[model samples]
Target: MTRLLGGIGAQVLAVLAAVGRVAIFAAVTLRHLVTPPFYGREFLGALLNIGWLSLPVVGLTAVFTGGALALQIYAGGSRFDAEAVVPQIVAIGMVRELGPVLVGLMIAARVTSSIAAEIATMKVTEQIDALVTLSTHPMKYLTVPRVLAGLVTVPLLVGVGDIIGIFGGYQVAVRSLGFNPATYLQNTVDFLEPLDVLSSLVKGAAFGVIATLMGCYSGMNSGRGAQGVGAATKSSVEAASVLILAANFLLTGVFFSA
Candidate 1:
């Protein structure tokens, strides 16, 4: 019984310690963000990697999700002869929740894993140490650019995903479900409030920060060798994905739970 309790206590402390380390990492990243010999070249590379390269996946996911959502809402609404609500529901659903959340998860799976693996490998190869010996701050060079890129570009991705998702629903509704094309488009536009869109973009920004930060943090703190890199990559994606969902829940409450 004593051993069990002690184990539980140790787990709790470990979790808290992890949280504290991430907090400090984030704080230092923010500080570097403000004051820097800004690395424009690295930042641009990260921007391309995190944003432009991510579009196809984001668009595909959003479109398919939107279409499925429309179908589900139509099927559900049929029970009450409320099929006309499909457009409104789809718009709200995509913009308010699904769009940002899905995009964030995709980014975590793709970008976060890539970042972690790359950095971890670099660490394993003593490249990070090389950076230090060359009078470079690894955090400023390695972490700041990626985090900034995520911050800047993820909201844009969310906005794009929201639009693509709404378009997908529009296509499904008008083509498959006998909704008037004009009316479907109008309803989607009319039903979405500015706040819904704002919330989505905001969630994207938060998710971006979490995803990139976790990847960098895990990579920097990774142990040694190939096993460590693999572990870091896996953990970075897992942490980013979980944190993004949690942040979505909290942000939704803050924005909508009036």
Candidate 2:
């Protein structure tokens, strides 16, 4: 029993130490953002990779989730004879919670793994050292651009996801659920407050930062070989996904608790 307790305490301390390291990494990265010698081409490439390339997956995920949510809400509402409320419910649900969370998780799965693997491989190849040799700050050249691009573009992705999701619900409702297209849209528009959209975009920014930061941190600190690269890639996605969900919960409570 004593040994088990000791192990648990050691694990907790290790986790806390890891978190502290990540925080310091993030701070250093942010500080580099305002410094000169900005990498415009790299930033644009990262924007394209992290934001534009991610759209198809985000759209498909949002549309299917929204359609399924509409069906589920409709079925449940029918039991209460409140089926007509589907539009309002769907709108609020998509804008307030599902949109941001789904987009964030998708990014974690796709972008986080990609970033970690690529960077870890670069490190293993000694490219990071080469950058240092060339007098280029690796953090500024590599990490800053990606993190900045994510911070800027993910909110836009969330907005797009929210629209696509609402449209998906609208399609299902109007085509299969026998909802009047015009009235359904009107109800959806009327029910959603500006705050819902604002909170969603805010969550997107937060999740984006977490996703990219985890990837960069894991990659920079990765071990020295193929197995290390694989482990870093795996751990980056897992950590980003878990942190996204936890942040979502905390943000929701902050935004909604009154």
Candidate 3:
């Protein structure tokens, strides 16, 4: 039992060490955030890559999720003869919780994994080393733009997703559920305050930072060759997903808790 306990302790220590390394990387990256000689080209490119290109997917995800959520709420609420609350509930839930969380998770799977794999491949090909030899800082050149883009892009994406999601729920409620169009919409608008939307944007921003940081960190730390790249890609996705979900809880507390 002592031996087993010792092994578990060692594993826990290793995990903590890895997390510490990520924290150090984050601190170093943040230090460059306020410095001059900004990489405008990279930042703009990242904005296009991470934000503009991501809209269709994010919008689609939000629409379907909101529609499904409304349906579920209607079904459950009907059991209590409270189906009238579907539109309002769906609106609040989508903007406050589902919108940001779903968009964050989707971006984690798509953007985070892709970023990690691309960077890992570059690392494997010695591209990162070449940048170093050329006096180009990998952290600034590679990580900074992606992180900045995430900070700017994700919140926008989440906001867009929230709008689309509410629309989706509204559509389903009016058409399939036979809800009065004006009544449904009025209820949705009545319940949604400025704070609900703003909280979602904040959640999006945090999720974006968390996702991009995980991707950059895993890529930089990836070991040699194909196996390492695969490992890094997998790790980035896993970390981003867990972080996004955990962040949702925290953000919800901050936004909704009395």
Candidate 4:
């Protein structure tokens, strides 16, 4: 009993310590975001990597998800003969929840793993130490640019995802579900409030920050060698995915509660 209790207590403390470290890391990243000696080239590269390169995956995910969502809503609504509500439901669902959440998860899967692996490999190669030797802050050069790129590009990605997702639903609804194309488009546009759009973009920014920060933090703190890099990559994605979901729930409550 004593050993079990002690083990549980140690795990809890470790988790809390990790949370504290991440919070401090995030604070430091944000502080550097506003300071001098910004790395424009690195920021642009990160922007391209995190945003442009991610479009195909984001689009594919959004379109398929939107189509499936439409189909599900149609089937469910059919029980009550409320099938006509598909457009509004899809719009609200995508803009308010599905679009941002799915995009965040996809980013976590793709970008987070890449960031962690790259940084960890750099660490293994001693490039981070080389930066220190050259009088450069590793966090400023690597972490800040990636974090800023995430902040700037993720909202754009979310907007694109929301549009593509709505289009996907429109295609399914009009083509297969017998919804009038014009009416469906109108309904989608009419049903979406400015706040819904705002919330989706806001969620995008928050999730992006979480995803990139997790990757950077894990990479920076990763242990030695291949095993360490692999572990860091896995842990980064896992942590980002979990945090994104948790943050989504909290943001949803804050935005829609009342």
- What are the Cα lDDT values of the candidates? 0.96, 0.95, 0.92, 0.96
* Candidate 3 local lDDT, 1-258, one digit each (tens): 999999999999998998899889999999887776589998998888789988889999999988998899999999989999998899899889899999999889888998899899999999999999998889899899999999999999999999999999988988899999999989998998999989999999999999999999999989999999999999999999998999899988987899
Cα error of candidate 1 at position 45, Å: 0.2
Quote each prediction's TM-score: 0.99, 0.99, 0.97, 0.99
Clash list (residue pairs), candidate 2: none
Record all residue pairs in model 4 with backbone atoms less than 3 Å apart, i.e. clashing: none
Pairs of residues clashing in candidate 3:
none
Q: For residue 196, give model 2's deviation from the true position in Å.
A: 0.5
Candidate 4 lDDT tens digits, 1-258: 999999999999999999999999999988888899999999999999999999999999999989999999999999999999999999999999999999999999999999999999999999999999999999999999999889889989999999999999999999999999999999898989999999999999999999999999999999899999999999999999999999999999989998
Q: Total clashes, candidate 1?
A: 0
Worst 10 residues of 4 by lDDT: 26-35
In candidate 2, what are the lDDT values of residues 61-112, reduced to their tens digit?
9999999989999999999899999899999999999999999999999999
TM-score of 2: 0.99
